[model samples]
Target: MGEKLLMKGNEVIAEAAIRAGCRHYFGYPITPQTELMHYMAKKMPKVGGVFLQAESEVSAINMVYGAASTGKRVLTSSSSPGISLKQEGISYASGAQLPAVIVNIMRGGPGLGGIQPSQSDYFQATKGGGHGDYHMIVLAPSSVQELYELTVDAFNLADKYRILTMILGDGILGQMMEVVNFRDEEKIETYDKSWAANGHKNEREHNTITSIHIDPAVLEQWNIGYQKKYQLITESEQRYELYNCDDAEIILVAYGSVARICKGAIKEAAAQGIKLGLIRPITLWPFPVKGIEKIIDIPKAFLTVEMSSGQMLEDVRLAVDGRKPVYFTGRMGGMIPTVKNIMDKVMEIKERHS
Candidate 1:
């Protein structure tokens, strides 16, 4: 264990990134997540790391690509629209197989959406937001402490898989404050960065990092390799928590802030003699299919709680696969569904099934 400190979500996430040995940060200012950059700006230089504010999100992500090309732990962040601008660079990084971490503090969006927190980016994050036959290992943190722990995990996973990793937070989680315990974990893992473009100095074969393969056959082989890597990750990396699910008649499927609220709703439902539970995904890309599969007694119904228009509900639907009923309730444009709102939704599900 490490010392506990009171901190904001964004602040703790930045601190954890440093502990993960990330020495390069490139990002633009966006509300709800700007504080993360501010913290990095103040601390990176103090710790001999580099903190650079790029002219734009596109430039920022490309800078991440450059840093990672040297086999350095690198990171960047942005909100929804900014992340959209970064898609091309993210795809480039994927094509080049560069290991980097990206933080997306989501806000409502299709274009320049509202500054309010939202989970509407669920599809974009879980699916390939950028063009490519690739995926990022996406981690979602519901608490400030998770922001710390998972940010550390994100770095490790990115390096291990030699792929992009993302920490998906929302405006609520980014701006909220909580107690965080930072432990200096003794890392025993090693990554082979033989593909890095670090100068060979004529000591070995020239190493080049690129995604451009003109030969269709070569590109097809590369895609196949990526698919193998993804399969291994999916089998090993699905993470979720099942709270009081053994005999649950109804369960709430959520992640990030929405999951936090569902925890309370579970307690409320229990008091009303409703067997309610929660399945909170810590990794959105892998999507915890196995955890969803192991659900005992098959809860009568599952409700997806989100800050978007039922985006994650689609995954919940897919995982349930007609064995159980799946329902959804959400808020958008910065509105958050209250605990009462969530509890009410649970009651409605119970009543319908009753």
Candidate 2:
């Protein structure tokens, strides 16, 4: 353990990024996540970090593009609709293969929706919301501890792959307070940024950072290169946690706060002599398909619990691929499922399949 501190999830995320060596933060204020930017404004200057409150979400992400071009670790964050506005810059970052971290403290939305917590951004975050064939390393953290740890690692992951990484949290996690300890560890540089447009002062080649290629063939080959990197990430970056799944007749699949809710529900189910399990995907874009695949053919039913209208259920279905029955239960627009409601849904799935 390093030093223990009581902090809100959003504030911890900002501090963790700073500890992880990110010095540039560009973000616009949005509900449920404004605290993250607020924390940065308070601390970034003290740490000699650059904290710029851009005029809009669009401008903040582009500022991120600029900071990342020079190979400096940078971050930008927003809520749902604001995230949509950053999509274009995110895509450009992907095409340019720039390393940056984007935080999405999600809220309900198709247009300008509610300010309350919701996970409706599931598809947008994991499905390459921006244009072209590109991917962002997406991580979902369930608690304040994870919010801190994942934010720190998001920087490392973003730099390692030279691509955007998202710390995908919901409003509940953003607002909730918890005790977090920033563990002390030796700092070793993760990867090389030799391609950074830092400077040509030391008799080096002039490095250019761009996503555009005038020649179609060059762009096509560039896409091929990106696909190759994605393949490597897909192979090695999948993250998930299995809880009580060994003899679980029903396994709950969820992430973020929904996963924590399922944990409580599973406890109640166990008390009632029902075996319940959970598979929480920590890395959402790499989607833990292997984790689901390993549990396939286990003579069990897989039920996905979500705060959205079952966006992640599609991936669960694809992972199960008809081997076992897959069910979905969810609430929308910031409404959380009560523990009893979750237990009832579990019982319902058991009733249908049993």
Candidate 3:
């Protein structure tokens, strides 16, 4: 336990990663998330860590790959367009089964979109951003406090699972200020790297960290092994926050900054005698689909609010399994959707149900 201090979500995430034992950071400058890299530059040196501003996002992610292969804790961060540039390295890290953390302070984008917050990367983050038969452990933070906590958890989970882990946030969540409680600096656990590629001089034989498999049979075996790890993650890592769900006849499904707006809307709807509740996901990849399935019988309608066009709505539909009607409302290109706007959609859905 520790005292709370007001901090922006991006700064808190960088500080939290340091506390989680991250010693190397490589990233390019990008709007909304630039503060994160700046913070790391100043603080990492003081803590005997390395922070490098790469020439491009592609170079930054490859730097992450190099550092992570050394079994050292490493990270990279960017906005949407920058993230797209890192996809190749990201896929390489996945194939190599390297443990590393990546942060995306999402901005609107099919290409070079606006700097404002948006959840348009939902599909990219959850469905494997790069070309590959793989998935990263994607965690979404809705508040500054959760940003800190999840950043630490992201590192731990990445190390434990030996895979890439992402902290998926939007511009609003990245820039917002809130009080955050940080773990004691001395109490953070140092990762044990019995499997890391440190050095093989004094050990048995040399261990090479790579993804290239020349033999087809060996590649097939590796794929199966990786799939097994992913299955374990799916079963054990689903996380969500439920509010006022016990007797609600309608549910709101959302994540990231959109969830905060939906929270207020749910409260107002409750006051107006509307049986509305909220299901906010913390882990987007292992998405709490089972938890949602358990409550599907209670809600006649489920409304999904997102900053993207309609990415997360697809997950809601899959979770609902056609048991109830699912509706969607979205605002694109870096615009924030308001509580009133979401509530209006909720009201419309309620009326249609009646």
C-alpha TM-scores of all predictions: 0.97, 0.98, 0.97
Compose the digit string of candidate 2's lDDT tens values, residues 1-354: 689999999999998999889899999999989999999999999999999999999999999999999999999999999999999999999999999999999998778889889999999998989999999999999999999889888998898899899999999999999999778862635789989998989799799999999899999999999999999999999999998888789889999999999999988988999988899999998999999987775646998999999999999898888889898889999888878878888878878887
Residue 148 local lDDT, model 2: 89
* Candidate 3 lDDT (Cα, 0 to 1): 0.90
The C-alpha local distance difference test score for the whole of candidate 1 amounts to: 0.89
Residue runs of model 1 more than 4 Å from their true location after superposition: 185-188
* Clash count of each predicted structure: 0, 0, 0
Quantify all predictions' global Cα lDDT against the true fold: 0.89, 0.92, 0.90
Point out the higher-scoring one by TM-score: 1 or 2. Answer: 2
- For candidate 1, write residues 69-168 as lDDT tens digits: 9999998988888889999998999999999999999998778889989988888888989998999999999999999889888998999999999999
Pairs with backbone N, CA or C atoms under 3 Å apart (clashes), candidate 1: none
Q: Give the number of the best model, judged by TM-score.
A: 2
Candidate 3: give the clashing pairs: none
TM-score result, candidate 1: 0.97
Most lDDT-accurate candidate: 2
**Candidate 3 C-alpha error for residue 266, in Å:** 1.0
Q: Lowest summed lDDT over 10 consecutive residues: which window, candidate 3? A: 183-192
